[model samples]
Target chain A: MRPFSFTKIDNAANALAAKKEKSQFIAGGTNLVDLMKKNIAQPEQVLDVTTALSSEIEDFTKGIRIGAMARNSALTTNAIVLEKYPLVSKAVLAGASPQIRNMASTAGNLLQRTRCPYFYDVTTACNKRKPNSGCSALEGENRMSAVIGYSEQCVAVHPSDLCVALAALDAKVNIENSKNKKSVISFGDFHRLPGNEPNRDNNLPENALITSVEIPSNGFQKHSAYLKIRDRDSYAFALVSVAAALELQGTRIVAARLASGGVAHKPWRWYDAEAFLKGKEATAANFSEAANIAVQDLKPLAHNGFKKEMLQGAIATALQQCLTV
Target chain B: MSKESTYSRRAFLKASGAFVMLASIPYSLKAMYVDVDKLTVVPKQALSITVSINKKSYSVPADTRTTLLDLLREELHLTGAKKGCDHGQCGACTVHVDGERVLSCLTLSAMIQGKEVTTIEGLADGEKLHPMQQAFIECDGFQCGYCTPGQIMSAVACVKEGHTGSVAEIKEFMSGNLCRCGAYNGIVQSIQKVANA
Candidate 1:
């Protein structure tokens, strides 16, 4: 790892002030530390805001506010989350290992770099690591690469299960700008498509600190489910994952929210599929059709072509599981 | 030349060659140790910090880039917390920080100031083994024993966290610590015994 000056900041102001041209804010450091070890990231300074940021998952009238520093472990079992946003709870629990969840913070999870093998290997050509270097995953072993929202520059997917759930439920990111002015960005707008800037993960303003994730009250909480298909039961990134919730009136769907992971640069919110399901019956055939519509415009790579079909099954399964939940 | 003589000559040359490289490393490696210091010796004036580990207070000079795993294994000589996969794909660096199990491999040591850290060395009460440790021994919960410390630490936390309600739950919670020997059955049995007890 490259040697860097480290500062332990006490508040958002200090954290924002500590950011330099070649600096990174450290919370859990689960992802950042790994990146540094591999030299994929070499910062001249590391600003630790673990103490500065609150880890509490606070309850509010409209919804719950997850502190940016909230550990994945704590977030998984928050009473408000489990009682209201059960899908969020399930998604956090489904990710990483126990110790990692205990250490990883919510904002850090959202800001986690992709686990694209080529990205981690500094010797390889990865646009995410070095823009204009060309993407190795486009032709390399890309079974885990993106199936949608991909560009000629990058095919890596955002590797956060929580983000998928947050996108599904319309969670918002609370950020403190460089000028110390606080603002909120919608979940949809927070993460960006790879497009031309795969190097930049989110739309977080420069020198801004993510303070919290606000999950507004929603009807999907009651009929929500998360299903992640992977090579293993745990400790593996999803090949394709789905977070879905339905609002049904009798046998007819009143509303629907869905997003998929491991299929796109950002959480692929199934807005089209959700629109299709708004007035449809809550049946396997209808759910399958919604899944079909969602993945209709996918641009799958050679090795990850299987993810196109896998995503369809995952969506149907997650939607079906919502009724049981 | 005789095979033995040739082998001895080659070995002697290699040893002397390594010695020469080691001799020049202080000056040469400083330029390439990834830092200003000569290799891993971080300057005390720049990054000196205090942290409590295994109930002992330590005010060691650590690198800003050093991980808690490196701090324990390399600095404090606390080898109990093994470094299996330094990237945290394996949980061999599991340790208790503020009474919660966490992967020390990913935890930067400099950021742990004023925080209490507990490792396998501190798990035992002087001479007596922690219940989880005793259970692991009784259940023969290891083969090579490389991942034992992390497994035991995670297992203890799993029970304390009340995640040992069933075999499946125990397995799920303890999935972080991996054993190449595939000693999961025994490991799960040990956790179950401790949780039940």
Candidate 2:
């Protein structure tokens, strides 16, 4: 890795002031340090914002606010999260490993880059690494590439299990701008699809720091499940994962929120499938129909064509688990 | 505004203009115009950091790019924490930071300036091994003994965090520490023994 200067920021103002064109915010440093070691990310300066950021988990009357610096393990083991937002806890635990979860922060988890092998190989041409360089994953090994919302420039999928659950739970990201003004970004609008510019992963503006993720209270707390299918039983990225949450009135589904991972550049929410499942009987047949509808619009690549079938099966299994709960 | 100031400003503008013009040229061609000696000169700076490891405080100068694992093994000569993969993939560099288990390979040395770090070397009380260490021995939780330190550190944490409810839970929580010899059966047994006692 190239030599770089490190600055410790004390507050939001100092953090904003320390920002440079070639500087990066280091939180947890799990992904950033690895990228730096690989020479994939060569930031001239690193701003240590972990200490400046809040790490509290606050609860309101209707929702809970998770601080940006809250560790992934803390979120997974938090009493409130395990009790009320079990899907969030399950999703966070499904990612990485125990040691990684203990070090990774909540905001850093969302800002993590894609795990596409081509993107990490510096010798290979990757649009996300160097703009207009051309994506090797487009024609090379792309079994883990996106099946939907993919462009010719890039086909990498965002690899965060927490974000998938947040998308389904309708979580809001609280961000502080350079002007010190705060704003909330809905989870759906946070991550961007790989269109012309695959270099830009999320819609976070320049000098805007994420403060917390707010998850609103919902009736689906009792019936929600995060099912992640990977190459192994644990400590691996999701091949096809589903976060299903249902609000059931007796046997009928009053509301449903479903999102999928490892299939798109962003968490692919199946709003159509969710609508179809709402007001329907919570049964295996209804879940199968919803899963079918969810996978109908996927555009899979040559190697990742199996993801479509995996997506259907995962969605069905996730919905069945939610209903059984 | 002054005559001397205006003259100096013009000189500054002319020098900056030539520098920008030279920089705009492609790297292969810019070498022809730039002096090799001047082009080769670049500043390299290392930051001073003080970290407390295993209850001992050490002040050292480390590059900003130095990871905690490198600082411990290379600088401090604390090699108990192995460097497997060194990319946070394998949990060979597992250690306790402020009483929580974390991957030292991924953590920057500069980030843990004031935090307390507990490595494998600090697990025992002088000659007496930690209970988790003794359990690993009793259960034969290692083959080549390469990933043993990390497994023991994580096992201690897993039992403390109350994740040793079952064999499946133990495996899931200990998934970060990969054992190439497939000593998972013994590793799980070690954790179960500690948790039960």
* Predictions: Cα RMSD each: 11.9, 3.6
What is the clash count of model 1?
A: 0
Instruction: Identify the CAPRI category of the predicted complex in candidate 1.
Output: acceptable
Q: Which ten-residue region of model 2 chain A has the weakest summed lDDT?
A: A9-18
Candidate fnat values, all = 0.70, 0.84
- Where is model 2 more than 4 Å wrong at Cα? B1-42
Among all candidates shown, the one with the greatest DockQ: 2
Pick by TM-score: which candidate is best?
2
Write model 1 residue lDDT over A50-99, tens digit each, in one string: 88998889889999999999999887777888898899989998899989
Model 1 chain B: weakest 10-residue lDDT segment is: B37-46
- Which regions of candidate 1 are displaced past 4 Å? B1-45
TM-score of chain B for predicted candidate 2: 0.81
Model 1, range B1-197, lDDT digits (tens) per residue? 77688679779999999999888777657666666543453233247769999889999887777789989999889999998989988999999999999999999888788999999999999899999999999999999999999999999999999999898898889889999999999999998898888
